[model samples]
Target: MPPEPVAGPAADIDSLFQRGYDRLYADDSTGAVRAFAAAVCLEPGHGEAWAALAEANGGGAAAVQAYAHAVVVDPGGWMWRVGLAEALRLAGSLNDAIAAYRELSGERADSAIVRLGHARALSVAGRPAEALAEYREAVALRPDDAEAALELAEALTGSGDALAAVELLQPLSRRAPDDAGLHHAVGRAWIALREPEKALTALRRARDLDAEDRLGAAPLIAALEAGEGADLSAAYVRALFDRYADRFDQDLLGKLGYAAPELLRAAVDRVIGPATGLRVFDLGCGTGLAGIGFRPLAGFLAGVDLSPRMVEKARERALYDDLRVGDVVAALEEVPESWNLLVAADVLVYLGDLAPVFAASAKALVPGGRFAATVERSAEEGFTLGPTRRYAHAEAYVRATAEAAGLTIRLMEHCTPRREKGVGVPGLLFVAERPADRPQIA
Candidate 1:
């Protein structure tokens, strides 16, 4: 997928190396690996062959070893170093990726592409501020480059400076009038600036240009909805969580002041007392924030999430006894009546209809077991999907839903689940208990 490791023509190259190149372009990764392995065997000094071998092997442990060998054989090959850095980044070795990226910067600080790559690595490592600095440098190096401008605009947006991002992207939009992605970026920045009309205009233009472009379609649909929708698409939610898995905690907790997990744990404690040795299940657990907080109260803990990457991230924390990668409802069905304490803090935002989740939570809980969670509160009856792509539920609707689902409300209180743009997001914290006399779920 990365361009050939070597510079210039491969016309004079050995037969094995040429055979490997043919196999690689043909998409036969295994054959390419074997051919490249043969080429490197014949010429142990061929750094390019080793690098090619690494790529053909899909950049696993073997790839890392081969890339390391390539770098050693050709210490001056910046391309090989870049390959290794990219491999490390894909493998979730963020620190190693950053170190390798720094090595590239040391070789050529003015290389805009290398600087951009380093900035991206830093972003993935949850160092957005540092990534912003690198992006600034990259933009300064190549002001007219569309790629660098896009990166800088995205970084500025993430840093809560949509006006700055708009300024950066406006000129690019004019320069590349036909670029659908550029328009999409500008529309998102406008939306952040509270200019919904402008965002709609730009997004509509983007969709007109490229109907199938992913960024334009999802946001365009959300923008078109304005303040009403049943719920967001499952595919979109999965993609969003997967992409944010790396920086979910840093952005939500440190940047946005998200305290739902702590609040939910406290509420649970008040309802069941502290350290009750409950069997806990965390629905839509992203990185196990709530699970970690509830660990002391649990005799056994398990987690479930729609995004596999988010599940993997939670697994890395090693707090849960088990973790499932699929829909929350499907996960609940797997262990009916197994949990004494089920937590879904900040996860209800994705479901505009609370009936399904409420019913599932009721079925999954043992007699007298508690369901504690947070939800963005709606001013009107029932629920509505907000412009932020999260659903907000009304207090009356929640109470009625819990009653119908066979759960008794133990506690309901107002709280700020998190902040957006330094403003608190209004929400509700609730604890409901399955009736002790209710029949067990089949």
Candidate 2:
């Protein structure tokens, strides 16, 4: 036989599909999309072609539709399902993505990577318990998987099962002794378990390993050293806000059930007695959580956050007249004697020492202007840093600081702002006024 006849259209389509995959691997999404489309035209039944097109769709609705079609065409392909789940996750349909992962797991329950993906999806979807179970399954399948163990530990800690998380990571911690994240996880576990001394030791090691990456542990160490069990440093507070800045409203307010901003607003209404056309600056306003509460009371509203991402998100709400990215202390100093209302909700808990902040806020306010703030309750500790390294001043200390800064206390009361250790922590709300002739605090 001089020349052998080529196979059917399906074979031709397979060749074209190879070309498309090569294009995909070479980072030419558009070319790959075109090639894949051509392959699908050549064989009409090429499931991989549909999947390739879907992957190349780059967040387009048409791309998702193509992926859906690919899944329908080849419902048995684990690859297709994985691609679809990943695309959905990127599109921010976390719950839908999670459902896809679950479906994939049902089909291939023994796939360690799939199980790991499932766990990640669950964690992002805020189903930490389910995620933890999936992570455990993944670990059981492959015990030496460092990523699986570390991620599992994170989900466990985030879900408030720190002790269990520690157990999961204890062996890995011994092997990967120098991993900063591992040590940090151990420290967090100790902290959650209410063993401050142990937490201090582990967290200190974490910091020593990589100071930049392990920034949160410093505050926690300070808290332990200071003999305060329930205090955190400003750095820790900032880290908390930074990590949750994008999802603060949903995770903190929606999931964890917080209402600090609203509680502050109610307290302010009672003390200030409803005034119209008031200018309000929500200092430390991460993602405008407090701005929502200020909407009714404030005629002019502005917000500031240290994280630019938070400031951008706050701007998206159209609730702020201006949003600035800078340190709150600097922002306060820049706006000397301007705003009538300065509300710092859950802000002062970060400051181990309030003298500087008090002075800055005093300078920022107009004469007779009110500064309303919230602070987490702490037993008298004479200004020592706690394990969390955030300063929690006693009620008397806070009052003394405000008074020393030329702000006379107007209203002081206690309320529960948010939960700590599965229970609400007592917080104080104070509204103080800077007098006309502010006495200098030496």
Kindly give the number of clashing pairs for every candidate: 0, 14
lDDT of 2 by residue, 85-199 (tens): 8777767778888888888889888989889888888888878788889998999899989888888877766755566677777778789889887788888877765567778
Candidate No. with top TM-score? 1
Error of 2 at 110 (Å): 29
Clashing pairs in 1: none
Local distance difference test scores for all models = 0.83, 0.77
lDDT of 1 at 143: 93
The runs of at least 3 residues in candidate 2 whose Cα sits more than 4 Å from the true structure, single-residue gaps closed, are: 1-236, 381-391, 437-442
C-alpha RMSD of each candidate structure in angstroms:
12.0, 12.8
Model 2 vs truth, CA RMSD? 12.8
